[model samples]
Target: MGTADGDGLREFYSAQQPRLVGVVSLLTGSRAEAEDIVQEAFVRLVPRWGKVSRYDAPEAWVRLVAVRLAANRHRDRSRLTGLFHRLPREQAAPDPAEAYGGDLEQALAGLPMPTRQVVVLYYVCDLSVAQVADTLGIAEGTVKSRLARGREALGAALRSDDHA
Candidate 1:
């Protein structure tokens, strides 16, 4: 790529990286994992920057990649869990509620990954249902259903927390 192309990619990365990390973190429920996922997405984007930069919303490409990576990682982790015994680590991890430090974040974390992805992409990213469906490669109807379920679940969780 030319110097101008490199400069444009750098500027895009600077502007979009933090926001993408936040979106991925909400999707993955771990800031550390989100960082890694987002970074890898950008790495993958490097070669495609020439083409992707011309797109109306290049960030969407990166976000889609990061989301898919997070989903793949979750699936791999689940499969590995079936094959191996998990050993207790020496370090005690912080409670997710405390780590996230917000009732909404805790509630989102409680959601099933699929529901959480739809909720985060639609609400947090402010993407339209069609956009979300496109990003996730699902039907718009599926996105709508997931959003409905997510809203109900989040509402109940927040209500219960309020009562406690």
Candidate 2:
């Protein structure tokens, strides 16, 4: 790419990286893993920057790629778990919520992957249903359904936490 294209890509990365990482972290339930996934998404985007920069919403593309990567990682983990049953597992560190004393974060972490993606994309990323549908390559109705179910699950999780 030319210097101008490189500069544009840099600017885009600077503007979008934090939000993308936040979205991915919520989806993956691991801030460190989210950062890695988002970085890889940007790396993939760099080669297509010339075309991506012209999109009406390039951030949507980045979000889509990150979500897919997280899904793939989950699938790979599942497969590996089945294959390596004898291997001792390394424990993940304490939840990131411990740092902020945020029950909502923990509640969100409990959501199913598809529901969580819809919630994060709609509420956290502030995308519309159509945008999220496009990002996830699902029907708009599917996005709405996930959003409704996700909201109900999150509400129940938070309420239970409060009573506890």
* Top TM-score hit: 1
TM-score per prediction, in order, is 0.86, 0.84
lDDT of each: 0.88, 0.84
TM-score of 2: 0.84
The whole-model C-alpha lDDT of candidate 2 against the native structure comes to 0.84
lDDT, candidate 1, 28-138, per-residue tens: 778999999999999999999999999999999999999999989978966775454444544444344454333787788878788999999999999999999999999
| Span of ten consecutive residues with least summed lDDT in model 2 | 93-102
User: Model 1: which ten-residue window has the lowest total lDDT?
Assistant: 93-102
Task: Give the Å shift of residue 152 in candidate 1.
Answer: 0.9
